[model samples]
Target: MMYHLLPSPYESQEINHLTLAYFVISSLDFLNSLHLLTHKEAVSDWVLSFHLHPTTIPDPNNGQFYGFHGSRTSMFPPDQTGALLHNNSHLASTYSALAILKIVGYDLSNIDSELMLSSMRNLQQSDGSFIPIHTGGEKDLRFVYCAAAICFMLNNWSGMDKEKAKDYILHCQSYDGGFGLVPGAESQDLHVTFIEMMYHLLPSPYESQEINHLTLAYFVISSLDFLNSLHLLTHKEAVSDWVLSFHLHPTTIPDPNNGQFYGFHGSRTSMFPPDQTGALLHNNSHLASTYSALAILKIVGYDLSNIDSELMLSSMRNLQQSDGSFIPIHTGGEKDLRFVYCAAAICFMLNNWSGMDKEKAKDYILHCQSYDGGFGLVPGAESQGGATYCAIASLRLMGFIEDNLLSTCASSSLIDVPLLLDWIVQRQGTDGGIQGRPNKSSDTCYAFWIGAVLKILGGYDFVDSKALHGFLLACQYKYGGFSKFPGEFPDLYHTYYAFTASSMLEESGFNSLCPELGITQVAAKGL
Candidate 1:
C-alpha cells in the first residue's frame, strides 16, 4: 500500500530516488533481512552508475563538482557545442550511494575516491561552510556537518579545512545562545538606525517568548555538553536563576492553580483579583515547557530541592484524563503521546510514582499502538517515528519493559516487542536513512526518533552502524549542521538529531546520549 503511489505533491521529489533507495535497503539491513533483497548486485551497479568521475568531464573546473547525481534524470545530453553540460554531482546523493553500497556489502574501493574527495574539497567555501553542489546555493551548518561526515567516512580530512569550518560553526551562534541558520543574523542588534526604521512595527524588545528561550538554551547547553566544554559556563548561578523564574508558586498568585504548575514564561495575565473562584484560569503551563525547563535546570546543576516537587506533582496529576492520556494543561488543546512522555519524564526525574497512575498511563499508551506494530500520536492514527519514540520512552521511564508488559497484563502484552522491532527496523529505506512514516522520504531526525527506540529495545546490535554513518555523512551540508534528508538544506533541528543519533550508535567522536532524556550522558549528570 505504501510503495506504488508517489502523491502528486511528491512528484517534484522524484529526483530523491537515490535517497529513497538508501532508506529501504538500510531498513532491510536493520531488520536483519538484507539477504531477503533480490538483485543486490544489480542495485549496487545502478548506484555506482550515478558516480561522476572527473576523467569523464573535459573541464578541470567541472571536475571539482564530481561526485554522484541524485538520479539519472540529472543527466542531460551533450550541448550542441559539445562542452561539458552543467549537470553536476550532489554531495547528498553521493552520500546516499556510498551508504547503500556499503549496506549491500560493497567496499568503496571500486569508486574513484580521489576524484570524489577532490570535488568535495572544492565545495568548501572561504567561510568554511559548504554549498551542496555549487557556489550559488545558500551555505549553512547542514552542509558542513555533511562534509565532516563524508570526510570521516572516506578516512580523509583533506576535503574540508576543519579549523575554518569550526570557526564558521561558532560564528553561527547567536547572542541568545542558539546557533541560527546564518552567522550573526539570528541576533537582533537594536542598532539605532535599524531601530528607528521599524520602531513602530516591532513588538517590545524586552518581550521574548519563554519556549523560544528554552529551545535556545537546550541547543547551546547540549552543544557544549557534546563538546565536553560545559565547564566554560562560568556564570552558572545566573543561568540557573533565569531558569528558576519560570516556576509558578502558590504564594505569588491568588488562585488555587498558582504554584501548582510551571508556565512557559511569565503569566499571560495578572493574578486573579483575590475573589476569583473555581480553578483559577490564567497562565497555564505546558508539558513541553515543563520538560525543557526541568532539563535545562538539571543541565545547569540547580538544586532540585529548591523546586516545589509536591505542588508540581499535584499539577501533573491534574493534567491526566481518565483514559490515562495527558494534556499539557487545563486549557483545551490537542493531546497526544508527546505530553504523556513529558509527564513520565517529570515523574521519573522527581522519583515519585504519585504524580501519575502508571497502570492507566500504560493502558493509554497500549491503546495508541497502531496496526503496523508501531505507535501513533493517538489511537488508530498513522505511526510516526517521533510518536513511537515518545510512546516507548514513556513506557521505559515508567519502568515497563518487555518482561514487565507481559507479566502485568499477562492476558495481553501492552507492547508487542517483536512486531515493533520489525516495524522500527523497517523504517530505514533504500537510502540508508530512516523515515518517520511509511512511504515518506527518509528524514535525518528519525535517526533519533527511531534510533532511540531501537536503543531501548536492545536492537542496536541488529543495526548496520556503518550504513547509518554513511547516510549521515551524505546528509551533511558544506556547512556545520545536518539536514532532514539527503540533498536538503540543513537545520538546527536535524543537526541536533543527527548528533544524538550518532551518539546512540556510539559512533566514534560523539558523546554518549542518554536515551531517556535526549541529552549527552555528561549533561544528565547535573540531575
Candidate 2:
C-alpha cells in the first residue's frame, strides 16, 4: 500500500500525497513491520526526489522556499535553462519527506541541511507566525509544529527564529488553560462542531434575553452603511422612526443628578409600559442599547441634533459610577471597559462630554491595562481582545489618546505600547484569523475588534492581511454574510465586523470605517 498510488477517494488530496506516504511508512515502523518492505533504497530515492534545491548558492531572501513538494503536480516543470521551479515547496511536505528518508535509514547528512534551514527562514513572519509556503499560506500552530519537527530531524536551529516562534507558542495559551492552534484562539476540541451546534440550537435563557435587539439593529444598519448599500434599505424614514421609538424620553429636561437613566431599551420585552400620567413605570433604559440606537440613527442619516440631546446626556450621567466606570443600564449592571466604551462613543457621537468625567474614565481605562500590555474588561482581569479595543477606542474617542500612538511618541503614550503590540500581533493565528482572547477559536468579530485596535495604534500593517483575507473568505456564507468560525452559519454581528475588517484592509467596494465610532466615515462625518 505504501508503494502504490492512493485510491480514487484520495485524488482530491493529491496535494498531500507526501504526507499520506509518511503516515503509512511511520505506521509500519511503529508496528514493527518495516522488514516487510522491500527495495528500501528505491523508496528513499523517491522521497528525495521531492526535495527542492537551489540552482546557485542558497539565497534565503530570494523569495522562494526551498523544501519538498507534496506531490508531482505541485512540483512544476523546470524553466528553459532546466532550473527547477521551487515555488511550491511547503514546510509540512518537507517535514514528511525528511521523515520518510529517515525511516528508510538513508544518510540524512547527505541532504543539503544548510540550504534547507536557511531557506526556511523566509516563511517566518515578524509576529512569529510561520507560513507553510513561501508564496503565502495560513500561519498557525500546525506549520510551526512542522517547522520544529523538520529542525529536530536535521539538528538545525538556523532554519527559524526560535525565540520568535517560542513567543508565538506561549501566546496560544487560552484563558481556560489550554493551548489553541494559534494565539487568541480557543483550545482545540474534537467536540467543537457538536458544541457549536448545541450553542446555536439551545442558547442559555439569560444569554438569549441579554441579546440586545437594538445592538443587532446597529450591526445591520452599520453593515449596510459600510457596504455603501444603505440605499438598499427601503423606508429609511420608517427605520429611523422605529429606532427612535426605543429611546426613553423625559417629559422635561432631565436632571443630571437623577438616579434614573433616560436611554433606550434593549428590546420591547425589556421596555416597561408607561403609567396613566405617561411616566415610565420602570426605567429599563440601558447605555449599550442607547449607543446602538444612536449609531443606527446616524447610519440612517437621521439628524441627531433634532433628538433630546440634553435629556439623553444628563440622564446618561446617572449611569456613570464615581469610579468613572459605567453600568450598561440605570437599573445597574457590570461596570467594565465595555460600558465605558459605549459611554465614550455615545458622548463622541453626541458632541457632548457632560455624560461622564473624562479624567476619571481615562484613569479607569489606564488601570485596566494588564502587566502583559493587553487591557481587560476590568482592572486586574485577564487581558482580552475586546477589552483592549474598548479601552483604546474609548480613549481615542475621548481625545485622551491620539491615532497612531506607536508612531507618535510611543514612549510617552499612556499605555505600554511595546507590550500591547506584542500581545495583539500574536492574536493572528496560523490560519490568519484574529482571536479575542488567548486559546479561543478565531472568530469573525475579532477581525474588527482586534483589527481596529491595530489600526488605531498604527500597527495594522504588522498583521498578515493576506492570511486574514483567506480566513474571512473561508468564513463567508455561500448565500451572504459571515460566520463566527469558518463552516458555521452566519450572524449579524460577525458579518458586520467582517465588513469593517475588510474595509480596514482597504478591500474595494467597502466604505472606509471610522474605527472609534464603528460606523462609515461618511456617516460619522454627518455627525
Candidate 3:
C-alpha cells in the first residue's frame, strides 16, 4: 500500500532510481551468495543501437570541455542525435555510476580529462557552495557538501570561489546556533549546520571553541545521526557525549522501546521542526536516520558490547521484501541505491548481516547491472555510482564474488571482472573523468565510489592516476566548492564526496579541502 505511492520504476530522466536490483544483490552479497548470477542475461546490452565512449564539446581556448549525452531517453528515439545533452554533472550520479562499474569489476581507465573538468567548472558557485549543475536549483548545505566532496576527489578547486563561498555558508547560520537551507530561513536544520560548519566554520588549525560549543551541543542527535561523514569534529569527546544523549529513551543500549531510536528531536530531528511538539517522534525509520545514526556512533566510539544489536538489526529486517531490496523504513516507500547504501552501512558498522537475506539480494543487484556493463540503482535501472557502491560494498561485506558472480556458470563465463572494468573505463569522457551512465558526462564526485570500488576489487594497478588526478585538479573552482560537470556550478554533496574520493586517491589536494575543523581524511577517501 505505501510503496505504490512512492517514485515508481525508473523514469529515463531518473538517473538515480530504485528497485529490486541493488537491494537484492546487496542482500545476496551480505549473505555471501554469488550463485544468483547464474539465473539471468541481467547483463546483455541496453539503449540499443547506441554505442559506448562519451562525446564532448569545448568551453573555450583554455582547455575546458562540456560533456553531454547523445540522449537521455530510456527508449530509442528515431533521431539519434536529437537526444538532450546531459550537461548536468551531478555529484550523486557521478559517483554512483563509477561504483556500479566497480561492482561489475571494471577498472576506471577510460575517464576523459577535459569533459570531467568542464562539468566541474560548470557547477561551481562564487560562494563557497556548489550547485548540482548550471540547470539551477536552490543553493544550500546539500549542494555545498557535494561540491566540497567533488573538489576533494579530483584535486581540483577551479570550480569554486572559496572566499565568497565560505562567506555565503556563514551567512546561512541562524540565531538558534544552526544553519538553514538558505540565509534568514525559518527552517533551521542541524543537519545543514553540521555540514556547513565543518566546511566553512572552524578556522584552520581548528581551535574555535565557539564552533565546537555551537556544533557539539546543538546538532540534532535523534536516531543518532549527525552528518554523512566524520573527521570534522574539533572535540571528539564532546560529540560522543552529545550522541549518547539520544539513546536516553531507549533501554541503555541502542534498543527499542520500539527498538529503533526515535527519528526526530532536538530540532533538525523533526520533519516540521519550528512549530512541532516536544520533538514529535516520526513513527518512522529512514535510511538517512539509520546511516547518520550509525556514522555518529562510529565517530563517537560506542562499544557495541553493551548494545542490543539483534533488536536494531531486526528493525531494518522488517523492511526487506521478497524481491530482496529494502524499503526506506516501515513506511514502505521507495527503494534505491541511497537506502540500500544506508542499510549496508548500518550492517557494516555493526559487523552483522542477519537482518537481510543475502543471496536474493545479490540477484537483485545483478539484474540492475545495465547492458552497458555498469551497475544501476535497481534492477532494470540505469547504472549509478552511489547505487553501484552500495551493491559492491554490500557484496564485498557479505563475501560474495569469492569465485566471482559469473565464474560458476557452465554455459557462460563471460561475466568476469575485466569486462565490467572495460565498461567502466569506457564511461570516462574526453577529460579523463568517469561519467555516471553511458551517454552521460563526468562529474567530480565519482572519484570515491568508482575509485574505491576499483581498489577494493584488487584492480587499483590499472587506473591512470596522472590523468585522473589532473582532471580532478582542473575541475576545481577558485572558490572552495566543486561543480557537477565542468562548466557547471558547485554543490555540497559533490564537494563532500569529491573530498572523500581525493583523499582515497592520495592526491595533493587533501589538506586544502578541509584544513579547518581537522578532517584531514574524509570517509569517502577511506572507502
Candidate 4:
C-alpha cells in the first residue's frame, strides 16, 4: 500500500515528499522487505538529486544552508554554470534524505560531508536554538533533533555547536519537568498531541471572547473598506451610531490619573442600564473594543474630533502598567503584546499619544523580542505569529520604528532587522501559505499577521506571492469567504485577513491596506 501510494499524485503533500519517502523506505527496511524494492540505484540517485551543493567553497557565514530540498518543487533550477540559483535546503529534508540514502546501502562517505556540516552552522541562533533552514525558521527542539540526527548519521560534530544546543534543550524544560518545543512554552504531551491530531482546531488567534462582537464589526467594516465597497452600507450613519453607543461616558470630567478606563464596551450584553439617579451600573469598557469601535467609526467617515478625545485618552492611561504593557480593560486582564497593539492603534487612530507613555511602551515591546528575532506575547515566551505582528505593528504605529525599516536604518535600528527578515521569510512554506511559527502548517490569517510585518520591514518582495495566492484560493469557500485552513468552514476573522493579505499582494478590486493600522490607506487617511 505504501509503495503504491508513493508514486501516486499527492498534490497537497508534495512539499513533504522526502519525509513521506523516509517513512516508506524506513518502514519497509524494518519489515525486512528491502529486497522487494527494485531500482535501488535509481532511488539513491532520486534522493541525491535533492542535495544542495555550494557553488563555491563553503562559508558558514554566507547564511545559506547546504542541505537537501524537501521536494522537487522546493528545489530551484541551476544556473548556466550548474550552480543553484537559490538554496531552499531544509534540515529536516536533509536528515530524511540521508536516512533514505543509508537504508538503500549507499556509501555516506561519498557525500560532501564538509560542505553540508559547515553550512549547517548558519541555522543555529545565538541562544543555541536551531532554525530548520538558513533562510530563517522557528528555533525549536524539532530542528535541534534533526540536526543531531544528521550529525550522528554523518559522524561529524562540526555541523553544530553542541554546547549551545544543549543549553537550548535545557531551557525548554518546563516547571513540570517535561520539555516544550521551545523555551517557556507548554509541555509537549497534550500540546503536541492536539497539534498532531487536529489541523482544523484553529486556536483562538487572539484572546478574550468578550470583544467578539466588536472584533466581528471591525472585520466587517474594515473588509468593506478594503474592497472599496464601504458605500454599499445604505445605513452608514446607523452603523456608526450603533458602534458609538458602546462608548462609556463619565458624568463629570474625571481625573486623568483616576485609575479608571473610559472606553467602549464590546457588546450590548456588557452594557448595563443606569440606576434611578441615571448613574451607570457598570463600565465594561475594553481597549480592544475601543480600538475596533474607533476603526469602524473611521471607516464610516465619522468625524473623530466630535468625540470626547481628551476623556478617552486621559482615562486610557489607567490600563497601562508600569512596565508599559496594557490590560485590555480597566478592571483587569492579561497584559501582553496584543493589548499593547490595540492601545497603539487606538492612539494612532485618535491622533493622541497621551493615553499611554510612548517611551515606557516602547521599552516594554523591546522586551518581548525573543532570541529568534520574532516577538512572543510576553517576555521569555516562545515566539508566535500574532505576537510578532503586534510588536512590529505597534512599533510602527508608535513611530518608534520607521516604515520599510530594512531599507532605511537597519544597521542602527533598535530591533534586529536581518534576523527578523530571515525568520519571517521562512514562514512561507513550500505550499505557499504562511505559518505563524516554525514547524507548523500554514494558515490563512498569518498571511496578514506575518505578511504585514514583512511589508513594514521592506521584506515583502522576498515572499512568493504567486504561491500564497494559490494557497488563499484553496481556502476560499464555494459559497463565499475563507476558512482558517482549506476545506473548512469559513469565518469572518479569517475572511477579513484574507482580503487584507490579498490587497497587500496588489490583488485587483481591493484597496491597498495601511499595514500598521490593519485598515485601508483611505480609511487611515480619513482619521
The C-alpha TM-scores of every prediction are 0.56, 0.61, 0.49, 0.60
Clash totals for all candidate models? 30, 9, 116, 0
lDDT by residue for model 4 (423-526), tens: 88889999999999999999999999999998988878888876887788678665556789988976777878988898887654468899998999888999
lDDT of 1 by residue, 1-527 (tens): 12335568866877887887788788888889787777789889888888765334444345357677887778655567655466567788877888888888787777767666766777887767888886457688878887887777777777789998887786566545688665534322211122222212323442454335555466556655554446767787887787676665544433334334544443333234222443444655677767777777777778776787776787677777889988886665678899899899888776777778899899999999988899999998988999999998898888877523322533335677778878988988777888898899888888889988877766665566657766876776653566787777655567668778767755323568888788877666663
| Ordering by TM-score | 2, 4, 1, 3
Residues 1-527, candidate 2, lDDT per residue (tens digit)? 64466678898999998999999989999999898779899889899898887665656778778899999999887687756565799999999999999998998999988888888988988757789998897788899999899999999889989988887776666545677776534321212232233323434543574548778667766776776666767788998899888888766555666688888888888877778776666889888898899888888889999887777788788888888899988778799999999999999999999888999999999999999889999999999999999999999999877789876755545778889899999899999999988998898899999999989887788988768977987786655667899999866667778889988976544689898888999988884
Write down the lDDT that model 2 would get. Answer: 0.82
Residue-level error in angstroms, candidate 3, position 153? 39
Tens digit of lDDT per residue, candidate 3, span 192-252? 4534554445444435333232233322221112233334455657765654444323323
Best by lDDT: 4
Off by over 4 Å in 3: 1-232, 244-281, 304-307, 402-416, 487-489, 508-527
The numbered model that scores best in TM-score is 2
Off by over 4 Å in 1: 1-211, 252-260, 263-281, 402-412, 525-527
Model 4 misplaced stretches (Cα beyond 4 Å)? 1-211, 274-281
Using lDDT, rank the candidates from best to worst: 4, 2, 1, 3
Return whichever of 1 and 4 wins on lDDT. Answer: 4
Candidate 2 ranges with C-alpha deviation above 4 Å: 1-211, 252-254, 277-279
